[model samples]
Every structure is written in structure tokens, then in C-alpha cells.
Target: MRPAHGPGGAARAGDLPVLAVLYGRGAATPLGLTDTARGRCAVVFLGDLGDPLVAADLAPVSRTTRVVDTRGLTEAQLCALVVGLAPDGVVTFSDSLLRATAVAAKACGLPFHEPDTADVLVDKFRQRRALASAGVQSTACRLIRSAGDLAPALAATGLPAVIKPRAGCSSTDTCRVDSAEELAARYAEFTDGVTRPRAYVLEEYLVGDPSAVGDFWGDYVSVESVTRDGDTRTVGVTGKLPLAFPFRETGLFVPAELPADLVEQVVRLERRALRALGVREGVTHTEIKFTPGGPRVIEVNGRIGGGISDILKRSSGVDLLAHAVDAALGAFDPPEPVLGLDGSGRRVAFQYLVSPPSDACVPGGDELLDDLYDIPGVDLVDVGITPGWRADWRAGTEWILGTVYGSAPGFAELRITLKAVQDRMASFWSEVEV
Candidate 1:
């Protein structure tokens, strides 16, 4: 196994180390880890590409360290790289990769979280089943491995159902089907590559206002503090605004507009759902809908929610990334909420800078980042666009053009500011060509 270097530029041959496996290069998990430890610890980068910031983030910690770049490697090859790292602990944000890593870690006699819990967190179908059996209010769902299984599943699930991949992220292969014919047509779209057999899930369509709660669970109960055994801290909540079809996220407003009672109810539901899934420790990103009956569970992710965390921290003055890493390292203590702030009643919005379809134009991320930074009270501006990456304007994925965050005095002021910023951004995009 390759030995990583400590913060002092010396080799960590016989010392305990923490391993973080990232699914993609642009993800915020690594950055979160770095912020939490402040380059005082060791880390490993596992992904197709390495972000310059990731290297920059770790450079201050140590000059010489083990970094296993897993780009273009098969699963077995990747496993070999992880084994070579020989880490005492492993951390992952990708659900699929987490499951695989858990198996490998267990076989190598490493103490780690179980894969079944991770599976239940990632696989929407499995999560729904577990929640339903545990008496949690969840949307009706059926797993369909083939077209042969589609009919029975549909009959069991009624009309206006949502069809999506069982383990997919970013709502990549999701579609809403109102009838059997629509389901067949949508199913045909998934007939290639990783989705060929198209192991899909059909769920009863839910309609209502949507919200997200970012929580952390401990050994005994869900709390705001990290436990000795890596229990997590449940922090503030952020309300999500999604686009029309496939439910791609559009914007996020910190500190949801719901009443205090509703917020408590949502928290209780999150605790119940996590307990049922056996997720004792770690961050949870849960999506739900406030229906006519009440709040219903949509899906729960074991890791933190992408992009939303930035807004939560920006508005609430709490760093979720730092807390997550501290919790994972058993050095976390819940900080008191930044209370009596004037920003609570105001709406702080994060709008995605997306390109419109027509010209194959690419966004000038650096320039936009600068513009957002210059804005007064702008909390964070994350540009997810990469050079040479094609932009499908119609694609129902959260490819943030850029995020603009700021607070308004009230809902009316929030609306005006949001529109003004959005219009300014739209004008900027109009001037650019493909």
C-alpha cells in the first residue's frame, strides 16, 4: 500500500488515515472535507478527474501524499487502488460507489458502515418499501426489471406515475408517464448503455409543495451533535424550487416558509425514516412533499445535498461541509444556531444560471463568478459549467450556470430582487453566441 504524507510533510506509514472516495471531480464533498479539517489531516481523491481546487485545498496540508487517480479504471482496478491506499477509515458521497466500497472494505477487514443501509438510501424503490413497511407515509412504488414486469407494476400503481431509474442521480433518466403507452415510449429511451435493461421504478405521482431538510443522525437518536461513533449533526432546512418536468432543481431559498409546527413534523418524519433505514450516523438530504394529507417522504440521500448546502451556510452562517467532516472524524460538536438574525424573515435565494436552448453557447463561468462575487450580500456563486462539456438546455439535470444568493426584507422584496438578477443574467446570456 502506498503511504500518504501527514500535515508535516512526513510519511504516514503506521498512522490511522481517513479515505474519501468521490464519484465525480466537481462534487463539493472533497471541498467540504478539506474545510472541516483545514488541511490538518490526510485525504485520498477517487474520481475520473482532479479539480484544481481539490489539489489546492490539500496542498497546504502536506506536500507529499498518496493520491490514487481512478479515471478510466474498471471496478476491479478501482478496488485494487483503494486496497493499495490501505486506509483505516473510508468516506464516500456517491451511493453506488459507497456500496461497492463498503463491500471491499468489509472483505479487507476494515471497520465501516454496512452496504445494505447505503443501498436503502440510494435505491428509491428500496427506500420506499422500507418506509412503507415501517408505517411512514410514502408514495406508492413498484420496481420493474423489464417490460414484462411493467404491466403488473402499473396495474398495482394506478395512473400518473413517475418512472425513473432505481439508483440514478440528478434525475437523469426520469420521466412522468400518465398511461401505459407513454411508459413504453419513455422506457425505450433507456435502452442503451448502463440503462439498457432499464431497471426502472414506477411510483404513484405525488402533487404538493416540496421541501428539503438536511439532518444528521446519531446512535441513539437524531440530533444536532456528532456522536463518538461518527453520528451526524442535523442542521437547518432549505426549501427547493424545481422546474416543470423530470423535477430538475431551479432555485433554493433558505429557512423554508412553512410554519413552526410543519417544520417539527418534517423533522420527526426524517427521524422516523432514517431510523427505519438503519442509518445511524451521517448526513441526510431528504426530499418531501406537503400534500393534502400531510408531508410525505420522497427520497432520502445519505450524503449532503449538492448546492443547497452552500445556501444554507450562506444564510444561516453555518458551514455544513466543515461540520460533516468534523463529524466523520469524531471531532464534531454542534454549534448553537445563529439566532436573532434579521435575515430569518427575509428570503435568501439561490438561482441557477442556465443557458437557453437554440445556440450551442457555453457559459463564461469565470466571468459570471466574478460578477456574482461583486454583488453586495451575495453569499456564494458556484459555477458547475466545464469547458468542452456540451450543454443540453432542455436536459432535466441540475447543471448550475451559477448560483446567486442574497437576502431580501420580505417575500415581495425577494421577488423583485430575484427577477432583477435573473433578468440581468438573461441579458448577459443573450449577448453571448454558441
Candidate 2:
């Protein structure tokens, strides 16, 4: 374990809340939680990524890092480690570790998602069942265990259905099957990389309204929120810039360009769905679609939307990470009143620089970033993949070369600005032989 305050660190952030962050499943850079946390910041990270976050990453943020091999550690053992930290709260950003962290939080007597109910929050099949039981309009779903199980699951979900891992992220191993043959072919393709077979969910397909398709407004949007003691409040809604196939996210535009009334409807469904899932507290990222029948939930995530914390801050003037930690520490008050969707400005957006299909080696990231920074309205450029990395389209947006974030004065201007930057960035990559 590392010291609470690293050498020369501020003597315990005065009276601000101290948080034990189970750092995993987020960007390498420090997040709003680590940045805005007031008191002692202790991080327990699992992995051999030496000095998981380099000093350069932490130069701009405040946190104490403890890299541990948590692979085989029991929830209780992890809790004991966090308990020793004497933290006011224990929380995690990783989807893969949410249940364990919830358990650890419970063992430490901290405010968090209840340990018992946490599983349903991350397990897709269980989520569908819970939402259905609550009369929330989620897709009908069936659990798939093997090839033979697909027929029954397919029957339940219908043709042109969706199939995805019950416990998956980054849209990995997810697909849309339009026919029995396609299901068989894509099932094998989707399941190709499994080391051990896991339960999957075959769900009814949700077709979004085609009319809503525009330059950036895709068929769906994600609702950003924070909850406390069974009551949830909206942070804002984010629109997608048309995801890659098999459901790879491309970008998020905050304060989704929708009529104010429809955004309210989405919020209504989100609150009802969260209540249904028994998400008593913490932050949530719920994706909903503009279906022909109106907005219906696609899925709900019981954490902050990865990579969009800055967007939330830009649009809503609230730090979601700080708010979430504050909720966990039971100091559940917003520094500034959270803005409603209407109040959340329309300019904030984040765009990914995806790996193009061509056999192209992108220009050196340092050079490209310098070019991107020169673009007007480009506020932030995060290079995910460097120039030497080969692009593999078989994977999802995880292959994106980088991400760009910015805001303009209005929706139209923001879109135009992003398009201009994107256009300017188009020629920065050139093909290379394999």
C-alpha cells in the first residue's frame, strides 16, 4: 500500500472528504473524482501496469496510488484493505468490478449500491428481468448458454434480435442477427474469442426512429444521473454520433438535440427504470432509444459514462465524479445545483478518432495532437493509440486512435465546429503495408 499523502502532498485536503477509489475501468488520466476530491485520496488499483498512472498523469491531479494484485483477493480481503485506509467512502469505476466494490463498500459500512442487488446492475439478463418485473419497457430477453440454447432464445426474442454477453462492456461480442442463418454465423463470430463460455442474452431488437437521424443525433442517447437513498436526479442527457456496428460507441454529445419534452420523457423512464432496478444510490449511465413507439431503454449502467465526465462538466457545470463520491461518503449535496436538460447547454461534445479500415499508420500522435490543438474549437485531444499501433477494425471503438472534446456557443455551431475539425483531421493518416 502507498502512503495516504504522497511525499510533499497537501496535508490531507483540509476538511474535504477522503475517498478510497478502487481505480479501474477508466481513462489513464485522473478523473473528476480524483481531481475534485477534497480530502485524502487513496487509490487501490489491480494490475501490473507499472506505476499504473505515471507522474505526468498525476501532475495535474491529486491522488495516492497503491498498486495491488487483486486478482484472487476475496471481497472481504479487499474491504479490509480499504477499511485500513479509513476512508469516508469506497467506490469503483470499472464495470467488471462493480459487484465486488459494492460488497467491499457494504463490508466497510459505507454508502454504495447494496451488495446483494449489485449483481443485477451489471448482469444484462438479470437487468432485463428486474426491469420487466417493474413494468419498465425493456426488451424481452432470454439467456443463451450454447448453440442449442440459441433456438429457444431466438424464439423468445424474435428474428432480427440482439445477442450480447450477459456481462460485457465496450460492445464486445455483441451483434444483431437478422435471420437464423445470420444468427448462427454471427454467433460463432461473436463467440470466437471466448476462453470460457459465459451466459449471453438474446434480446428483442429495438429499432429507433429513422426520422431522427441527422449529422450527429443518432437513434439513441444516454441519460447521465446521480441517485441518493432511492431518489435519482438527472445530470443531463447525451446523444450519440452514430455508433459503429455491433454497437461500438463513437462519440457523445451532451444535452442531446431533442425537443425538451422528449428529453423529459426519457428522464421519466430512466428514473422509473432505476427505481425498478433498485439502484438506491450512486451514479448511473442509462442508454435509451428513440423508438417508433417513443423512447425505450436500451440498457442501464450503474456508473458514470466512461470518457464523458468532462463533457458533463462542460454542459452541466457539475462534476459527476465528485458528486458520486460525495454521495458515497454520504455528504450528498451538490456544490452547485445540477442543471436540468434545458439548462444544460447544447455545445458540449466528444468525438473519437477511430482506426480507419485502410492499412494506414496514423501520423505521430504528438504531431497530430499539435495539429488538432491548432484547430479552432478543439478543447481537448486524447491520444488513445499512438502512430505505431496497427488498426484492427474487428474490435469495436476500442481501436479508436484518439478522442477530441470541445464546446461551442450553440448546437449548430458546435456541430459545424466539430465537422470542421474532423475534416481537417481526415488527412493526418496515410496507408502503410502490413
Candidate 3:
């Protein structure tokens, strides 16, 4: 564990409210969170990152930063740490840490999602039951702890079902099962190891309504909300690009292009799901898909959506990370963020992703990031690789090689820019078996 403060991190932040973030692997970069939170309050990035945030990472941000080492800490132990921090609020941008963090927050009497709500938020199977019991939407689901549990899961979820870890993030290890044989085979493969047993949820597959979103857009949209003591205020609905093969996300855009009625339905369903899960206070990202029957919830994540901060900040002048911290502290709304590149002019911003097909060597590495600037409307590009890695289909968006974030004046322009970038990017890779 490293020291909690860097340089002058212990300096007083002018008596501002203290916000302790349970930081780890999740949405929002350490810098992004700090940038948004600069003067609003003092921030303590507390958690086990297994390494200190490099000085380069902390160099730019002003104000005090308390980066504590919290490895090997239990909930009660974490609660003790929180008490020592003496924070006004506790929050996490991580889905995996949501539950334990909630327990710690509650013990400290800090504002956060309570334990029960946090449990449902992180566990897909439990969430499904909660929603169904509350009459939100009932999609058949079964939890499987071992291979022998497959029969009941298959019976309940049926063929063409979706299988995923009960509590996972960014679609990792999530896949669709098409047939009884494939379902059994997948279950066997997933639990192959005499490695410790794992728990997964077999769910009724949600077929996206192509007619609802047409082409180019994903059938699903995530509703972003800021909830305070159970009263949720919706920020907006985000649109997404069509998923890559086997359910990996390809991209996402801001201000989803939904009909007025559809937006109403998505928001209404999100509110119900949140209520059912009992998410009282948090910045949440709930994914709802429009299906043949109607809009249905895919899952409700308690923290900010992965990559949501980038798209939101690019598309609108909103700092979602800042909002999360403020929600934790109470209704501490600052003036609206400066929108767009020009402050007032807004654009159709997007986080376009590129993923390699399974069994293939990943494409161009970090070198190509330089070439990305030539693309029209391109603001930032980050392709995380040096090119020797193999693309595993099950890795989901976490394994995406790179992402391009930028904005266009309108949907048409944004669409054109996206296509051009995708086409240009594909040329960087010569597909080959890994």
C-alpha cells in the first residue's frame, strides 16, 4: 500500500466538503474525476488499485488528493477507514465494488445506495426477481452455481437464452446460447475448471426490435439518472451503436435518437427498475432494450456506465463524474457545464469502438493513435495494445482494442464521420488466426 497523499495532497481544500471515492477499475479516469471535482470539494481516491497512480496521472490536478491504500480491508475495516477520512459522502464509480462500498457507507452514515439495493444492483439474477416481483418486467431467469444446475436453468430460460456472470461488468463473460447443445456446451466450458465454482445467471434472451431503432443504432439505450434519497432525476437517455459479434458493444452516442413516446417508456421503466432495486442515492446507468414486446430492462448498474463520462462530456457540456460526487454529498448542483467545443454549440458526440474478431490477432497498436487525428471530427483516440494479443470473443468491451471519441454537428454528419473512421481503421488490421 502506498501513502494516501501525493506531494501536497494533504493540504486543506479550503474547508470544502470531502468526497471519498471507492476508486478502482471502472468508468471515469482518475484525472477526469479530479478535473470535474476540482473546486467543488476535496477528493480522496481510496481503494486498492494494487499500484499508486503515477505522478504523471496526478500532476495536472489541483486541490488535495488523498490516495489511500485499502488492500486487504473488510467492510467493517473499510468503514473504520471511512470514519478516519471523515468524509461528507462516499461514492464509487465501480460496479464490482458497489455492494461492499454501500455497506461501508451505511456504517459510516454517509449517503450511498444501501446494502440491499446495492446487492440487487450488482446481481443480475437477484435484480430480475426483484423487477418481476415489483411488476416492472418479468423475463425468466435462473441462477446456476455448477454444471448440474443447467437443466433447471435451461428449462426456465429456454433455448436462445443469454448466460452471464451474476455480477459482472462491461459485458465480460456474457454470451448468447442458441441451442440446447450449445447451452450445455457453454456451461461446461464456462465452468470447466475444477477451479472454484462460479455463479451465473441464465436469462431469457432479449431480441432487439430492429424496427424500433432501425439501422446503425443499437436497440438498447441507457438511462442516466441522479437519485437522492429515492427521488431520481433523469439526466438523459444515451443511444448506442449496433453491437459487435457475440454481444460486444461497438460504440455509443449521446442523446439517443428515440421518439418522444419511446423516451417516455424507457424513462418510466428505468424509474420502476430503480425503485424495485431500491437505489435511493447514486448516479446510476440502467440499460433498457426495446424488444418485440416492448422496452425491457437488460440490467441496472449502480455506478456510472463504462465510457459514459466521455460520451456525455463530449456530447453535452455535462460532467457526469462531477454529478456523481455531488449526488453523494447532497444536492450540490453547480451551474451547467460549458457545452461543446465552443462552450455553447453542441454536437452529436460518440465513443466509437473497434474490436477484433475471435481467434484473430489484434490490429494496429498504439502507433495508429497518431493517424487517427486525420479523421474528421476526431477529438481523442486510445487503442490500448502493442499488437500481439489475441482477441477472445468472450472478453466483451473491456477487450476492445481502442476507442475514438468526437462530435459532429448532426446525426447525418456524425454517421458519416463514424463510417469513415471505421473504414479507415479496418485497413490498419490484416486479419489472421492468432
Best by TM-score: 3
The whole-model lDDT of each prediction reads 0.59, 0.70, 0.79
How would you encode candidate 1's per-residue C-alpha lDDT over 193-218 as one tens digit per residue? 55347578999987653332222110
lDDT per residue (tens digit) for residues 1-434 in model 2: 22353323333433444466675544323545544663534443433133344333444443354444444567778777667656667777767778877977887788888875689888999998898889887578998888898888888889789888898777766778899888888778766888877778889999878576464567898888888887677877777776655576767766677776877788899989988888888888898988789888888888887766777677666677777767877866644422234443434555544545344454544666667677667788776654357755445566677678777666777677767766666676666776
Pitting candidate 1 against candidate 2, the one with the higher TM-score is 2
Task: Choose 2 or 3, whichever is better by TM-score.
Answer: 3
Q: Which stretches of model 2 miss by more than 4 angstroms?
A: 1-17, 27-33, 38-68, 193-195, 213-215, 335-349, 352-375, 384-388, 422-434
Q: Compose the digit string of candidate 3's lDDT tens values, residues 337-358.
A: 2221333577778898877645
Best-to-worst order by lDDT is 3, 2, 1
TM-score of each: 0.76, 0.84, 0.90
TM-score of candidate 3 versus the correct structure, residues matched by position: 0.90
lDDT of predicted model 3: 0.79
